[model samples]
Target chain A: MNYLLDAFAWIADPAHQAGPNGIWARLGEHLGYSVVGVLLACLVAVPAGLWVGHTGRGRGLAVGLASAARALPTLGLVTLLGLLLGIGLVGPMIAFVALALPSILAGTYAGVEAADRVAVDGARAAGMTEWQVLTRVELPLGMPLLIGGIRSAFLQVVATATLAAYVGAGGLGRFLFLGLRTQDYPQMLAASLLVVGLALVADIAFGLLQRFATPAGLRTTR
Target chain B: MRWIGDNLDVIGGHLVSHLLLAVPPIVASFLLALPVGWLAGRVRWLRAPLLSAAGLLYAIPSLPLFVVLPLVIGTGVRDATNIIVALTLYGLALMVPATADALRSVDPRVVDAADALGYGGVRRFLTVELPVAGPTLLAGLRVVAVSTISLVTVGAVLGVPSLGMLFTDGFQRNIMPSILAGIVLTIALALVVDALLVALGRLVLPWTRPAAAAVVAPTQAEVAP
Candidate 1:
């Protein structure tokens, strides 16, 4: 109870809210890395996943790889990468990208696979090129799921970004680290609250994006 | 034969410590998560916010949390203290989504049917909604347990005595065998925790098997075909 009060006090303090201590700057830097990581995952995973889903031959391999990716403990992966990259955001960044890929890949696969079969046949009957059929029909239908994958990857990257702080990548985790070292409960609470708050705000925004992407029928059903 | 005698104590100690570190946090997180999740489900506006909150909580980096926690509660692991708090935060991710989705996914028709049958709101939720939602909720618990097992390694990195400590100790001392031992033991611990959760699911919620295992497990037909 007392600890909670102290935490609130620290968050409320005018001094702590200033300049570098501004919540957005700390969270913004963290989000920047997360965006980069997810963008990189999407760049590769989306196209590869799209092709795999379109043909259905390489899907087994794709799914296998995604599961293998999940099987890896993120910390273990990061530590292993750390050995090669040297302790910094780079190692953690690679691990985060790896973490984001499986979801994006899977989501993209499902999205494209779920495209209406008739539409594709109709496009073929109309003499559309394979690429045209995909671009005009498959990718459009796949957008919601693809966006879902992006959202999932983004949330994951955001959460995992905290881990980067371990190897000296700066973020809200610094306050968390400091609180632990100094036994400053208020500071720790404040930092944790901030991180959680940041994540919640991001998720709500993502949910809105999902709703927007959702087809009208589904939105009403939901 | 020589290796057995030389490392028996170290191996045994780590085994006990690892279980001690991992189990309580998972159990505590479940206890904290259930009611909160149920409450969030009852209120329509609350669901997204609650889930988002949980997701964010789950995203927290464990190492920083470990370092920051000592300042908040004045350190040292008590059954009611620092470790449980950390574990609770970690579990929040799995718990919130699992619980919320379970509740949300309860077929809307079922809830409507209960209302038509003259069941009160609370009764409808408890008798009708909760049962159908059982499998999904359990699935969430299972995810939390596995993730918690992995995240517990953060404790060792922070100088907490556990299997993670063994890993850290072995790493620092450059003792290859011990590091290998820690990795093996931690994997064993995670696997065991996961297996136990699966067993619990089968026992408590039989229908949950389809929802949980189907995604992660290969169908027999897929394999045999």
Candidate 2:
């Protein structure tokens, strides 16, 4: 009880705040980098997932890569990548992409795989090319799932980005690591609270996105 | 040939570290979640709060949680309390969902039948509810097990000598063989553990397979017998 209370006190103390501006400013910089990383991961994984799922041709290979990527721990992957890329944001960037890929691929695959096959077949029968069938029928049907994958990837990047602090990439993890080193309970608790809060917010945002992105007819079954 | 022959002991040590790092948390999470999940089902008011707390705990970043834990307690790789606490939080999130799902998966008709027969409270639960829910519970346990094994790597980020340590050491040294070995071993461990969970689930909850399938097979056929 005392430990939890003391940690909260430390965070609340004006004197304990880092930098001249406050924690929020520090947060803004970290969020910038982390969001950029997540965006890059989305750009890669979502497209790759769409291709794999929409085509149904590379699913096994995609699943294998995704599972392998997920199995690779962030610390090891980031640190190793850091060794190759020489630290900074690039290492964590790659690691988060690897972390987010499986979920994205799974979501994308499950989404398109679940699409009504008859509609797609009908489109093809009605003089639509395979490409036209995909764009006009399959892709729209798969939008909610594709968006869901993006949402999961976004949350993953947000939470895991804290590890970037280990390599001096700077994020909420900085506060967490610093607090541990200094035995500053408040800072550690504060950082943890912020990260958890951010995750909850993201989850809520994703819930809203799901409602909006999904066609109303589809939402009922889901 | 010389390199492979000479460093056999170190490689063996790495393998041991990897196994040790992976197993404990899984064993612990399953044992711990069963009772908590059971308690949650028994106590209606406790379910929501406990689940929410578990979710919050689950969202914590692994590295940060490990680093912070040592400050609350003392530091050491063998600091079982810290490792257990850190992992308990992680496993708790999965377990709550798993347990709730397991319980929810139980056929309400089974529960009603038990009640209709005058098998009340603990008697009904021991013989009917829990037995019926067993497969669902084991399914949850499987998820918890897989998750625990993977996240145990978090312990390595704190410099605990485990499989994750091997990965970290190799990464620091830029040794591909060692790094690859760690990754491969961890995946192998996860696969083996998951397979074992499946086998255990099948053995313990034999009825679940048919029951689960039956639930979705045209409710009209199930007309209140």
Candidate 3:
């Protein structure tokens, strides 16, 4: 009970909430890496996912990639890349992109799969170009799941970005590492609470975004 | 290569410990999740709250979970049981959802038919629902096994010996080989375990061999040439 109070005290401490090493600053760095990582992953995974979903080719590859990505240890990957690329945000960012890609890709293609097949067939028969079929028919129908993919990707990257501290970048993980070294259970607890709180906020926010983004007609159909 | 050869004994020990640390959590979490997942699958109202609660477990970073869980569970920070408990929670996060989906994917009529045949609650689930849920459950197991194996390394920071120690050592000491070995070994372990699960699935779930395996099994009479 005392430890819990101390953790909250540490978080609420105005002294601890300012300057470069402050809680807000660390949170910024963590969110920055996470947001950038998911966006970068979207660039590569989204296009490939759309092509695979529309063409129905390489479906197996996408599924395999996502599962394989899920199995990798985030810590090992961050350190491995840190050694290879030299320690900084760049290395962790790359790892996050790799980690987030497969989930997003799978979500993207699965969304397209979830769309009404008859509508897709009609779009094709109506002489729409391949791109038109994808954009007009698939994109709108598949947007929800695609966003869902982004949500998962965002969640994953945010959590894994904590390892960014290990690689000598700034994030909430610094507090975790710092707390452990100093035996400051309060600091460690505070950091953990922050990370979890960040995740919950992100998850709920994404849940709302996913809800609102869905075409209202399709919402009832599901 | 020489670095790897020189460190083989150390690496081998970590590998064994890694396996030891990983397998139990995967097994325990699967067992623990079955009832909860089954309940969620059967009861419509419970599904969201149960799954969302399970997912909250995943949001807790392994690093912090490793450090702080000892507080709640009454164990030393470095205890293997500590990591085991933490990893099991992680496994439950993934497994419950997977298990629920696995059960939900089965044909409702098969369950009804089992009830119609005088099978009681436990018997119906064990004989009828369990077999049909096998392929998807096994699929979930594969992911759980792979991820759990890799996650075992995170315990190294707290001084639990495993392949993750190599990562910690390599990072602090600038020993490139050690880090490489950890990454390679973790990935290799994950892949090998995943393949074993797939093979185990094939051996145990023969009904799943056919294209219509989901609807096959005891209801084989319904499948036509």
Task: Name the best candidate (by TM-score).
Answer: 3
Candidate order by lDDT, decreasing, is: 3, 1, 2
Order of models, best TM-score first: 3, 2, 1
* Ten-residue stretch with the least lDDT total in model 2 chain A: A17-26
| CAPRI tier of model 2 | acceptable
Superposed model 2: Cα runs more than 4 Å off: A1-26, A116-144, A179-189, A219-222, B1-24, B31-54, B67-78, B108-136, B171-178, B202-225
Recovered share of real interface contacts in candidate 3: 0.53
Q: Judge candidate 1 at residue A186 and give its lDDT.
A: 71
Residue A100 in candidate 3 has what lDDT?
Answer: 89
Q: Give the alpha carbon lDDT tens digit for every residue of A92-145 in model 2.
A: 777777777777777877777777998878888899997787677777788788
DockQ of each: 0.18, 0.27, 0.59
lDDT of 2 by residue, B136-200 (tens): 66766666666566667656655566666656677667666665656666677777877888877
For candidate 3, what is the lDDT? 0.87
State residue A133's C-alpha deviation in candidate 2, in Å. 5.4
lDDT of 3 by residue, B117-201 (tens): 9999999889888889999999888878988898898888778998999999988888888988898889999988888888888
2 or 3: which has the higher TM-score?
A: 3
- TM-score of candidate 3 versus the correct structure, residues matched by position: 0.92
All candidates in order of DockQ, best leading: 3, 2, 1
